[model samples]
Target: RRRGGGGGVETAADFARTAPRAGYLHKLGTNVRQYKRRFFVLRPSTHLYYFLGPNDAEPRGCIELDGGGVSAVRELETMPDGRFRFEISLGGDGGEGDAGGMDASFASANDDGGGGRDGGGPRRIVLEARSAECGREWIDSLRSESLPYVRAELESSRSEADELRARCAALEARVEEMRLVERDRDGAV
Candidate 1:
């Protein structure tokens, strides 16, 4: 739940480094509406979703959560649906992520600024799991699955920043040395 520059810190895992989390859940079902059960694979490294249900051998829809693009996972208590519902708040410019599979969600992103990567707006993905325990497990798994990468990225960014600061200090010292030499020469002349 760290806040990033765009907003909250997102979990962008290195795709090649880790295994994806897979589960079966009911999606889009509200109190009144029926649910569609789908087998989803969440790749924390790329922050992409692979929705492959029992019927389809191949993934049906792929979504990219930018920068591993999730800020918060909260239950939608306000909604009338009695089902265990949670929403994944998306931050950063919504990227197509590298899903290989895109659907109406990808195509429609341009219309509502939902997937814009310009750091202008925010998007959300709401999912309703059949059970509350399952909902919690999903959240926990998602966070922990991305923990390694999050730590890795934080270290990488910190090191890069430190390196830049050191470089800047060296440049400043050189400037100071040049100024001293110029002053001494002027006095002598």
Candidate 2:
């Protein structure tokens, strides 16, 4: 579950076991467009978390790549200072609102330019990888992990919809029975 303050706690051993990728990456600030080096960890659960450093107990923020949280991931043809860079486009709302598990202070601190929360368009986070191979690996892993989470979410939604449909049908049948009883009473009179 996503909390409003920070990411879930994970010990070093547990983080190493659960995280497929954990390293330093330069993240472009949303408000200023300036790149800042951050320690990033990609968990098996399709959550990409970045912390102030590798030893931080909690993440500064989390990007949920499931249930329409992420829209696309692509490499940029132009390189910034010859770094292998890629952009992850977020879907509507981008899961960065009140429920995205991003610390309020962190968001406000980085978003001093006042453009971060305008909700104007899909939010994109650009990341610079250390090498071309690493960039490709990150892209592939993100794509692969995201699909299973999205599929699971879809399946859950379908099951809920089916249950709702069955309930609606039952209610309609009861209403019809009530109408028939009323009609019989009126005819008897």
Candidate 3:
């Protein structure tokens, strides 16, 4: 459980080099509702959740908690190129975090001077669900099956990018050949 941004001082490169923990994938449940509920029980962990928001520009969103008072929010923006560009930044001094506290019970959780986490103060999470069904579905996927699906989608995208590059290279070669043919014809004239 780290405190501020400076608290979790691991460099991005160091984080990438770290191996996934054992039983990390196995802990996930099959049902979405069950998974969302699990977060309430998490002792020390971080998770990203994908949320479909109001429109096309806001398809995917995320929630992250690192067992400390600090948390983050991200909104996914869909680009014209069929890719998602993330607009992400951590809230300063738990400003954005205040939204989750709208629910009365959450305040009770923080009633004590210390928040839920061990030795930490005020465990805050972001919550935004328009309707009950939407909220339920979002929580379920995040807790249960979303991780595997996201990984698979990333792999498929990489493969598609490789295929597209090969096709572009072939087209360039054909264009060069056509140019050479035109130069030969001009020389003959």
Q: After superposition, how far is residue 150 of candidate 2 from its true place, in Å?
A: 7.1
Q: Write the per-residue lDDT of candidate 1 for residues 1-189, one digit (tens) a residue.
A: 232455633222221125456667655432334446656677664454534343342354444543545665677643345457776666555443344344444333221122222254455555667677777777776665554556877899999999999999999999999999999999999
> After superposing candidate 2, which stretches have Cα over 4 Å from the reference?
1-14, 78-81, 97-119, 148-189
Clashing pairs in 1: 2-9, 4-7, 4-8, 4-9, 13-45, 93-117
The candidate that wins on TM-score is 2
Ranking by TM-score: 2, 1, 3
Backbone Cα, N, C clashes tallied per candidate: 6, 0, 1
Candidate models: Cα lDDT each: 0.55, 0.68, 0.34
lDDT of 2 at 66: 71
By TM-score, the better pick of 2 and 3 is 2
Give TM-scores for every candidate, taking all chains together and pairing residue i with residue i: 0.48, 0.60, 0.34
TM-score preference between candidates 1 and 3, better one: 1
Q: What's the distance in Å from true for residue 185, model 3?
A: 1.3
Q: Which candidate order results from sorting by lDDT in descending order?
A: 2, 1, 3
